[model samples]
Target: AAGVIQSPRHLIKEKRETATLKCYPIPRHDTVYWYQQGPGQDPQFLISFYEKMQSDKGSIPDRFSAQQFSDYHSELNMSSLELGDSALYFCASSVGGGGETQYFGPGTRLLVL
Candidate 1:
């Protein structure tokens, strides 16, 4: 019953700072995705990787980037943070191509002050 794992469950940052969030997907899963949820908003897809290659892109901002590793873990990098950037960031993993059931990790709550 292993699921996705995310680090630094919560983060506090000042304007213009940077933050990196990490995600470890379940074993054997090959597709990873990132999502961001702002206050009173639904989770929006940022990007996704399949088999270590960039597979899709969504609403991710220019100030952000992401990648997946050989072990299938992924990292989302955000920079020049702004107050509006505060939100819940989480990652999900699926078995193969997208459309499969994805398992999500506990979100990382980010706050900008």
Candidate 2:
């Protein structure tokens, strides 16, 4: 199957701007993998939604939120963005559940100016 797909692979926004990132999981996958990698840090597990419900919580800030739709895709909505929000946002999909094996997509690079 094809890998997860994230839109607008590269995004440039100013501080306080809002951005919506769409993630299309692999066909029939039931989980949305949301993680972020900052300037020199390892990938951090932000959160995940399984079967349209939040599966686990992480360090996601109040300004950021996410959702999984009936169709199995998800969206990471970032509002009141800050310069520190700049990072590579990644999405992945798994067949069974949140703890199952995951196939990651080419990440979305967000730059806040």
Candidate 3:
């Protein structure tokens, strides 16, 4: 399997702006997950999608959202981003279920000014 892939590698945004990041998971994978890892902090779960439907969501604000395509690719959208949103956003994937080990991508580092 090819695992997961994310783009931009890095991003810089001013407060109240919007940012869109992308992710593509290995073929045949049924689940895609998103997470946020801020400086000096562990990765925080953002959301998960299975079969193109959201299966779970974490404590992220409304400014954060995601979508899954038929090909198992996904995108994370942040609206009116704030300084607090600056972090490394990681996209991961696994077969559907909660106990499996997720494979992650290199991540897109977002720097909100």
Best by TM-score: 1
lDDT for predicted candidate 2 compared with the true structure:
0.91
lDDT value, residue 56 of candidate 3: 93
> Can you write out model 1's per-residue Cα lDDT over 1-112, one digit (the tens) per residue?
9989999899999999999999999999999999999999999999999999999999999999999999999999999999999999989999887657989999999999
Better of 2 and 3 by TM-score: 2
Predict model 3's lDDT versus the native. 0.90
| CA error at residue 43 for candidate 3, angstroms | 0.5
TM-score of 3: 0.94
Worst 10 residues of 2 by lDDT: 94-103
Which residue pairs show collisions in model 3?
none
True-vs-predicted CA distance for residue 62, candidate 3, Å:
0.7
lDDT of 3 by residue, 13-90 (tens): 999999999999877778999999999999999999998999999977897889999898999999998899999999
Please give the distance, in angstroms, between residue 98's alpha carbon in candidate 1 and its true position after superposition: 3.1
After best superposition, candidate 1 residue 48: deviation in angstroms?
0.4
- Give RMSD to native, each candidate: 0.8, 1.0, 1.2
Where does model 1 exceed 4 Å of error? none
- Per-residue C-alpha lDDT of model 2 across residues 24-75, encoded as one tens digit per residue: 9988889988999998999898889989999988999999999999898899
What overall lDDT goes with each candidate model?
0.94, 0.91, 0.90
What lDDT is reached at residue 90 by model 2?
Answer: 94
Q: Model 3: runs farther than 4 Å from truth?
A: none
